[model samples]
Target: MMNEIDLTKVDLEKPFMAGLMDGMPGGFFVYRGDETKKIIYANQKLLDIFDCDTWDEFVELTGGTFIGMVYARDRMIVHDYVRRARESGRTSGVTNYRIHTKKGVFKYVQNYANFVNDYVEGGLVYVFIAAARSTHDRLTGLPSMLNFLD
Candidate 1:
């Protein structure tokens, strides 16, 4: 039901916002939609999900980029989806992809992304606020094929 949010106006660096992001569930993160897709923020849950022990380690491993965490075969598909969403001016959408974990595991997660236009360095760029959760049965702690299909 939510339509749009002017993320450019939201102070993402505010301590309160960062605190809220930390408490949120799933793997919450924000990244640029530019060619670099630079990751600006990543919550602790995201680090835990990726099996990274610390933020510095995670950044080092992925080179502070989101694409580096994507499974090789899924990069194009995921990138194209983001591109389409941005072009359509869609604020949010659902997506699924395999992510490479720091533990050398590939995890399939259902992801939700919200797009915001941010003006940085006098240029307008896209910022993506994303949340990802395992495509698994919570009770059983097992991969759920049904969830993946959805």
Candidate 2:
């Protein structure tokens, strides 16, 4: 599977679509460079969790213009983590994270992995974000704290 990921392509707009589709039940995601951190490819499950039907629409909504996703407070952490992962070829995962979707819904996204791109398909050492929105706050970006907040 690793052999199939191309890194040189760097087509942030739409990279690694085939691998992601082939690897089912897995969270295969890619974001464009220079921020807005536009989501490139997030498997079928990811789309269901976020309630989105298309990737192009997601890009149009989010735009490829920011450095990272997450609320302002958490952006730095994500940025630093992604940066380090790229430089060190590290792989890690975060549990119980609240991430926003293209439609403005927040879901529990558990991002993991840091496999460096092979420069054939243009993956910048992608990170796999496995997410589940079943019990997320959705509003405050918390985990089912809705009842308490309300």
Best by lDDT: 1
Clashing pairs in 1: none
| Per-residue alpha-carbon lDDT of candidate 1 for residues 1-150, written as tens digits (9 for 90 to 100) | 988867667786887678878887667877776688778778888888778989998897788887876778888988898789778977788777777778888777666676666565321223222435566674796678876677
**Model 2 lDDT tens row, 37-122:** 55555566545555557765544544532333454555677678768755775555443355566677655666664444545644
> Whole-model Cα lDDT per candidate?
0.73, 0.54
The number of the candidate with the highest TM-score is 1
RMSD of 1: 6.7
Error of 2 at 135 (Å): 12
- Model 2 TM-score is 0.54
